[model samples]
Target chain A: MNTYDLIIVGAGPGGSVAAKIAAEKGLKTVFFERGRKPGEKNSSGCGLGPRMFRDFPEMMKKLTPEKCHSMRAGVAARNYFVNKDDIVAGYIMARPTESVSYEPAKSWITMNVYRSEFDPWIAEFATDAGAELKTSTLIIDLLKENGKVSGVIDDKGEKYKAPIVIGADGAVSTVAQKSGLRSKWSQNQVTLTLQYDFQAPSEKIDDIMGDETLAVWWGSNFPASYQVFFNDGFHQGLGNWMTWWDKTPLFYLNRVVNLKYYQRLLKILDAKPRELQAHLLPWLDYPYNTYTDGIILIGDAGGFPCPLEAEGIYPAMVTGKIAAEVAAEAVSSGDFSKESLKKFDEGWKKTSIGEEFEAGAELWNIWKALPFSPKETMSWFVPMIMEILGGIFDWSQPHGKRVRQIISHVKSYMPKATPFIMKNVFPLVAKIFEDDLDKIMDPKKIMKVLPKLLDMLPQKKKRRGSQEK
Target chain B: MKIELEGLTKRIPGTGEFISINSLKCNNCDRCLFVCVMNLWRKKEGKIYLAEDYQSKCLECAACFQVCDAGAIMFKYPAGGTGIVIEKG
Candidate 1:
């Protein structure tokens, strides 16, 4: 029989989690994966963070680094902005702070894993919970009865029927489009990254990349280039929104590793390219719509990634659990109408899903604006920022003389900084946070910022620039 | 920018033919050439084309579909379990 009480498409974290819960609730559940296995289609090889641990403690505990074939990164990250001369202009090392209340903070931040290994481990939860998993099955269309999604049709000639279907299929969600609940992601809505996974011995990686497992390099020529250190290897790539792909992401990513600034890290990785992969990532806010009739969308299909970091797995799993709850509610009541299924939307909003999606709305918009927006003055401002910041510790004279020298040095960065402040930072701050623009621009506020602005000018600048007007 | 795909592994399934180009809609800007990770899209006599052996090499990331603004490219996942087998990522 191809019928289940609930059917979930795409057995990534979302579908698997939903299937697990649906089965536990005594619903005959089945989940399908289009790839040969669950993780084969998933990409990015991203780090799974503390949110997963906190949310699903029991589920996470079983999938240790050894069990899941994952690399644990003890270090958080150190960020850098590199200049034209292949030198660091500025750096901020984010040391993990000691936590007083948050328990997860006492532990590491992220566990880097190969998606090929990670996704299957999570799928085990569903199977263990008695949820049937069908691999190598692609849902090409939805089965509708009286204009409501009743089931799904796989790429094979088989059909699966259920009262409810959860679309956990990712960014190019065929389920979402076929159900008429959503459309294709526009260029601005999505971005893709191109990466080459470089291999090395596990011990070699442990020594070469210690506390700085994540080393980010931001230059004008490339979209934020970064290296993600794994147990035996690392993934290096850069990406920008589709709207910004004038040269294609492949072009920009290839240029990133070859740059003089990245040569140092490249030498240490000293490994050959093992796998070259590109994956589409969703950068959307909490979507306006998620459920309709017998259909509910979760994960990337629902566009549930956090805007700040595009973290999808947590949202996918969280939304999947919520969707399954709603599915159980619908199955028991024998009501799968659009109105009844509306609870899926209400359920997610009341949880961290709402907070994450709503919070990152602004940051994601700013990121999208980076490449295509005409106001991008980063071309000039970054070089200037590098010179000022990169020279911050230089001291050839007495402490007093060095202090005075730094002041004069900051003067050159102002003209270029002015436009960037006005164009990008200032407006984003005013528009996103404060209700009243005038209050944010009040002279008191301006005074706090203007002293530095005034320092970028001539004569007695150091002393006069410090005092309030 | 040198692209080395010599180490790439893909399991072809039944002569995969999921991506197609609509030549009538082709503006010939040729963004497809560089965007392809596998470099499967080739240009012959100034017309962009794909080789018959593309199934063996294509990773099916559809970077070309994402970049083609002129509506000339049609892309779909090959038959289930029929495309790139990502072992590392």
Candidate 2:
């Protein structure tokens, strides 16, 4: 039997960072990796958020060479919203100087890295800082004694004891399963993601990525959006609500991959599609049970990925550090009960994880409201907007014809858009976007919205039904 | 047009069976079939059955078990250390 102060499972960012901090605090920590080496399980997401450097300055030293280069001189970026035809309907170009952060040092906002390289580097970094690292060891179960977790049992039946255990495992976490924390995540709580990695030479990669750190293509005509990020190569993928699977996720990926617009983008890059990767990400819309007596869960295991972007690294590492800090305090006080571990939850809530999760949920609520199937809002709305404006301003059409076109189209589209706008869009705007609706509300705005509101009102027949009843 | 691609290559390395559907408990609503991205579950003669020999394709996301409200789906990790190993993660 081997014992330590804390045993962390999974060598991804969360577990490795926890191991490092606990060891740095002289807690005699040990972390286990199921893979042969850290980062061997190559789950690729675009980058580290600015909060990563803010929360753990030490990670500044661990940035991959590519990340460092991107950070030193931020990459140009473009986001595109395309229709089914793959014609770009919306686009935004971003420079590093346009980053959202007020802190100049954090201005890069996010630096992309390949998880295969980054995860391994961080795990070795933790080992270098005194955390014992065990690789290729699959933890079979959490060892329990007196109704509390005391340690873990490996697949080989090897037992290692510790006062605290952190389930930093990815989405399919064994620790969460064996500890009676969760059996499975519901479809709404997780997103199924599938991506194709295109391996391109450095010069080619740079040329393809020129003036763009990330490019996104999406439209209501498609089942979901697609994103491509450039690092050592191009990683393009789609993630959609698990519940939305009319067909397998790969079916949608196939559609996107074969789309003319996507093919053109690849042609421009002249990149070779190397591998197809898939992973499940937990998108916790609300705070979840993350800690129990003598145990804590972080990262995807805790369902800590961002709801908005599905970005996991920053939140995982943030929660990992918080878990370690709380565990250290518990160890110093000689208390490792659920009461003490609850501090891990409270500590993390105080950090950006809580706020980011809230934001993700807010945005997701509106996003999920988009017509799931048999409706194409973007395809219809964009052209209609242009037509309406053209009718009013384009001047090519006669005034009477333009008025008729605008009125007829508005009348037809209003009914369909009304339900979504009133049901999903309005509540979102009222609750999340508008803090002072009274002040924001003007006579003109009300007049503008009134026709749609009137159109949404119950029809005469429906009102007659109500009267009859 | 179809885009040809390879499925997951690695295994979870387990002798223990991971997913089982209790036919007796299932209503054969086929919800599991629709939810499983791996196409592992199917309905035949109004009864749900898993595909023969496609268990290796399971991502183990448990979407089937989660969507099965009838408690017919039993999902556990393949015996510790045996199941899908994401070699490339």
**Candidate 1 local Cα displacement, residue A385, angstroms:** 3.7
Off by over 4 Å in 1: A98-101, A369-378, A397-411, A422-437, A443-453, A456-469, B1-3, B27-34, B42-48
For model 2 chain A, where is the 10-residue window of minimal lDDT?
A66-75
The residue pairs in collision within model 2 are A42-B88, A42-B89, A43-B89, B11-B85, B12-B82, B12-B83, B12-B84, B13-B82, B13-B83, B14-B82
Best of the candidates, DockQ: 1
Candidate 2 Cα outliers beyond 4 Å, as residue runs:
A66-74, A84-90, A96-99, A102-109, A371-469, B7-17, B55-62, B74-89
Clashing pairs in 1: A293-A338
Against the reference, the lDDT scores of all candidates come to: 0.76, 0.70
Q: Per-residue lDDT for A312-346 in model 2, tens only? A: 88888988899999989988998998888889888
